[model samples]
Target: MSDSEKQCCAPKRSRAGRPPDPAKDQAIMKAARDLFLERGFSGTTIEEIAANASVSKVTVYKRFCDKETLFEKCVRKEIGRMAEAFDVGDGSSEGLEQRLNAFGLKLTKFLTRPNHVALDRVMGQEFAQVPSLGKRMFEAGPGQSRARLAAVLQEACDDGILTCDDPLRAAEDLLVLWRGFIEVELKFAVRPAIDEESVRERVEHGTRTFLRAYQR
Candidate 1:
């Protein structure tokens, strides 16, 4: 079995005296995430999720009102776990270019993970059925990531490391630059899977280009 499969099956410890078991919640989310990625939203069922989680259908319902809600929670949980990609250091030490490179590498690598790519495909398919899912996922993930990167850029501007009238716009541009055609190619299987060296080269190129345009 794969590492992720093993992780899903691993026992989770929980605290006592809670009405809702955190362990059960983790199990449910793990099962739901795997099923959604493998089968997309429409194909996966609550019965399957409950079975995989070793919990009853009612237990799943008690934790999450519906399948849509459970899906959103799973996506949000993944996004929150990857949020540290935007850390970019304390801003008092790392140079703007260096920080951007670091952030770009982490962000792009996270975006291109097999599970994340699968999740994106699932979201694309489900958006037609659950219109609000796209909006909520964007706000919870990419929108929040952009805001964090914008704060980093704003800090650089304040420190005279860069010149930017709008940090948010700059952040978006940098993200687009970093993603480039790689994301499209990955999504469509137009090329072989990206390796660490290729990712680093792309990130470094983007960071340098961004600094050239924005550096004071």
Candidate 2:
């Protein structure tokens, strides 16, 4: 047998050993996220997160190099999940109002969550100190969300539902409608809770305003 033939016949490594528990990873990330939200990045500690997760300090260290790395991972994961929530449904034949309302409601619900509000606050407080964090937040969170929204808007435009020349800019404007209110409430802690009625009202009003400007 030639050396090349022998190499090609080498046994592949088995992945049969107990796979790393995704549940445990989720629990650890959730614990870290909550702690980071409750206390700003500087105030949160790895030991505190380990205790909250019911895992050993060594385990935490094995998973993440330090607080910054863990926080970045948590933020990126959360952003990806939020982006998934806005995935446009199969509504190609639906009325513009209906589609806009559905998207608006989903977006409002996401923005008004207490955890998301807490995350926004944490990012605001830390971004100046850690520039890379800002970049990651933009790329994974706002940037990704904007791109998704723009694609949907473009589709709507093509279907004659809207008159958008620049879907990206239009999407940004639509996002501003919900984001402005959330940012104000979170930054100042002015509103303790966003009731369901409030969420519905925001979505309805924002959707109407967006349609009015962009409708064909």
Candidate 3:
């Protein structure tokens, strides 16, 4: 066989000697994310992450190619957790209002968390410094959530349940309703972190108001 063919046909390497430790991975990710949030991306260092994670620099590098890659992974991990809230059920059995209320509540709680608020600040700073990183993070996180929400709105419109002419715009409107100006308040510490009752009340009001505007 030619060198290329032989290389392609070679036995795949087995990763059986020792499995990667999920605990260690989680520790590293948590450490890196917290550090990034506390001290903007430019201020954070791989050595600091390793020290905080209680792992060696070699261990950090083994899992992530470099600090940039590690930062990206950390961002994705945090956003991925938040993205779960966007999976409002298929618009079949559940009423759209119920789904929207549920989604709003979950999203509000996630976004208002201290860590998440800090993340938004760090993300903004990073975006100013490295637009590409910001773009990628937005695409992976909020952009995707908006698209998912738009999909739900479009489905409702197709079913004649809502009268949305523009699903994306409607989605944006609904999200704004749910979020309001809470993030700004939290970021500036002008208002305390929202409690669960406040979140529920906000979400319920937002869902009702959204339906009033969009319901067919």
lDDT of 1 by residue, 52-141 (tens): 999987777766767777887876776666555555455543455666777788788877767667667657777767678778767767
Full candidate order by TM-score, most accurate first = 1, 3, 2
Q: List the residue pairs that clash in candidate 3.
A: none
Over 1-216, each residue of candidate 3 has an lDDT whose tens digit, in order, gives 233322212123347855667787789899998888777677888789989999977677767756777777776675556556546566653577777777678778878988778767766876888888778777766886787778878988899889987999999999999999999999998986889999999888988888888887
Instruction: Give the 10-residue window scoring lowest on summed lDDT in candidate 3.
Output: 1-10
Give me candidate 1's TM-score against the actual structure: 0.79
lDDT of 1 at 126: 70
What is the per-residue lDDT of model 2 for residues 1-216, given as tens digits with 9 covering 90 to 100?
233322322123348865566676678899998887777677788788989998876666656656666787876776566555445455453455565566666667766778667766766767888788778767766787788778878988888777888999999998887555665775578887787787778777876788778887
Angstrom error of the Cα, residue 174, model 2: value is 0.3
Q: Candidate 3: misplaced stretches above 4 Å?
A: 1-23, 86-94
Root-mean-square deviation of every model:
6.9, 8.0, 6.3
Error of 2 at 154 (Å): 2.3
Best candidate (score: TM-score): 1
Q: What is the lDDT of candidate 3?
A: 0.77
**TM of each candidate vs. truth:** 0.79, 0.75, 0.76
